[model samples]
Target: MSRATVLACLVSSSVLALTVAAASPAQAAGVDYVALGDSYSSGVGAPGQSGLCLRSNYSYAAQWATRNSPATFQFLACSGAETDDVLDSQVPAMKSGADLVSITIGGNDAGFAPTVLTCLTSSDATCTAKVNEGKAYVANTLPGKLNATYTAIRNKAPGAKVVVLSYPNIFDTSAALCEMSMTKRKAINSGAQTLDDMIKARATAFGFTFADVRGNFTGHGVCAARPYLNGLTIIPPQNSYHPNANGYTLGYLPALTSAVS
Candidate 1:
């Protein structure tokens, strides 16, 4: 080769080397992260929602992906999605051997949102009955559903480090909530505990990490001095009970970081 051709080759090699050196260490390892689940994962109240799916850039999955800077990140979780929706829809978006996965589900499957609605819209006696009904669903039905979902996720991402997140109780157990009686609030919170326990067991069975935020949201519940979750969002009712920015950023993100590390 001529001297000019040798110089050109050297410049090309050096440029490629610089480009590779600029890439992050995480990128060198080739991480593929897939975030899947329901409203909480989709980031309903965390702001910058996209499309009708209600995905937010401030979502736990988004935050985690940003901090971790994966090679590729797929956000498939949707608002109001149940365990079945995740099995049928969300898991399809994942690639095999995902490096990291995060999910929050089972609340809708246990009729939690509708049960909370009953407490907000019913008489005290009827609210108690509905809360009890939700409790039964948690104990009798929600587990099997969670197992199917967790199993499906494992099958899809066999090598993934899956992090299963549990829902926090919306109300403080000791207080009379904004719209529901204290008796009804206590029952509903108990049901949430039951739901979390079921999810924890399912995650453990699959060898997945369970990140419980019940303690994090305890003093900052729906009726707390400075609440993280929305309380009775009347103008945009769909946002009710979902976490604000702090809940995902300060609350869920820390728990998830601990699990994955």
Candidate 2:
């Protein structure tokens, strides 16, 4: 064949190969997912249905589920859910055939926003002490709580791969954000990290997976660059302290992929 004709044939072959690859089925089948947690899991800020009990869409869990098409998802997460609440409410809502489960809890147990406000308003020593106390509470309480919750989950859905999510850094220590002093901000950040570590350790000990969104959110706490966290006023009329949609997308999707894969 002529060199020009040969080149054209090769090009056509390459295009056909690409098309075939694209048309192939995905690596894995759809999962029966159950999401359990608090407001973060409920997608409080992102645009969606904002009902009292069922705040749907824009949530990290929902977003993650949506990205993995053909997957059937059941989101049982709620706002203001404490650890006990997960045991009580979420466990009952879970189905027997769940293939994957993800949970983000413990914030309300620590009274997250109120704690932050208290630290922001208190003296350094007082704030440090309070944060320390909160950390101790989590360390002491979470293991048992998580164990019970996981046990119930296993009983209800034996085949599911359970994943526990760690909280992100909501307080930035850098001097750029004026909401709290650098020292206090550092304390809060350190406390949050400690909580995450505890959660990871417990999850590992219990043979469950830990999704470290905390580490993924480095330098992108409450005062991070645009899209990670919404400045100090992210809550709208309140200071910005939670992960925005972009932050959730960045920190959550990879973890979800790993959990299911």
| Top candidate by TM-score | 1
**Alpha carbon lDDT of residue 95, candidate 2?**
78
Taking the tens digit of each residue's C-alpha lDDT, what string does model 1 give over 19-43?
1112244642478889998889998
Q: What is the lDDT of residue 40 in candidate 2?
A: 67
Q: For residues 1-261, write the lDDT of model 2, one tens digit per residue.
A: 443443332222110011111111254245677888877677654456366533556677777665565357788888767778888888888877787888887766765665665675578898888888888888888678767877887788888788888888776555475667777888888888877887788778868888877666676676555435544442232213555666666765556656656
How far does residue 259 in candidate 1 sit from its true spot (Å)? Answer: 0.4
Off by over 4 Å in 2: 1-29, 54-56, 231-240
TM-scores for all predictions: 0.86, 0.82
Runs of candidate 1 exceeding 4 Å displacement = 1-29, 173-177
**Model 1 score (lDDT):** 0.77
Candidate 2 displacement at residue 173 in angstroms: 2.7
In terms of lDDT, the poorest run of 10 residues in model 1 is 13-22
How accurate locally, in lDDT, is each candidate? 0.77, 0.67
